[model samples]
Target: MDNKKDFLKQIMNDTGKGIKGYMKAQVTLMIITFIILGIGLTIIGAKHPILISAGIAILDIIPVLGAGIVMIPWAVINFIIGNKDMGADLATLYVILVILRQFIEPKIVGKEIGVRPLYTFIATILGSIILGPIGIILGPLAAVIISSIMKTKKKTDNRR
Candidate 1:
């Protein structure tokens, strides 16, 4: 029926918007990570800090591979080379990066997708518990889709 078609169309549109917004949030996070890593690496006297930070930032966004993929190995290499101070510094920087991402990701994603940070955080945690690693991505996406459906339904009801 036309009503069903319209409803589906509205849901799609809203969900699309939310997905795009989520992508924007991701880019914002990537930029923030790059800046922080660049500064921290430079402070720690790492060679080619900007380049390394950029690479790590890009990797951090990829599924199953994160900043730690490179940073942890690099830190271990430093340790093996007897550069204990550099290894310690790298480890500390990695921890800071992880903490900051955990703190800010939900807030940024929720704001972009029109959900509250608390809801986003809850969804992420639940998703991770239920669905495993992929749930972190899927949980927020599911929230966005559900939110779109609710908003569209509300608008349709209000029009009646």
Candidate 2:
């Protein structure tokens, strides 16, 4: 019984570490996204790319809503005023940001936890769908917790 308890404690500790790793990865992705957008906008001839990027990134950090908060309206205004090129650029940036978060985040996070990426991706998507913007963060974490619990249970059963 003591050995079993110790094993469970170890599993819990590993799970905590894994969760921390994923949160770190998420923040890293956010910062990287901001930097990429800032540089990209500057390259594309936008004024004050740094400020724009900073605002977008801060909005992106907010739950559910993302850079889209700034990008969508700005794009629309540009298009309405006949600056189609700038509007298109803004739209493209938004798409790229989403793609970067969706694709890269799961792979790196799953690798951090030593599990299959598919499940993590599924969790992320489902989380977004179920919980809105915050779901993306929560979903992956919930999956990790569930995964850790199942893994521990399996190990304990095997020993039994």
Q: Which model scores highest in TM-score? A: 1
Residue 27 of candidate 1: its Cα lDDT? Answer: 91
What is candidate 2's TM-score against the reference?
Answer: 0.82
Off by over 4 Å in 1: none
Q: Write model 1 residue lDDT over 21-55, tens digit each, in one string.
A: 88998899999999999999999999999999999
> Lowest lDDT 10-mer window, candidate 2?
58-67
**For every model shown, what is its TM-score relative to the native structure?**
0.92, 0.82
Relative to the unseen true structure, what is the C-alpha lDDT of residue 124 in candidate 2, on a scale of 0 to 100? Answer: 78
- Local distance difference test values of all predictions, in order: 0.89, 0.81
- Where is model 2 more than 4 Å wrong at Cα? 1-8
lDDT of 2: 0.81
What is the Cα-based TM-score of model 1? 0.92
Alpha carbon RMSD to native, model 1: 1.5
Instruction: Compute the lDDT of residue 19 as modeled in candidate 2.
Output: 79
Clashes of each: 0, 1
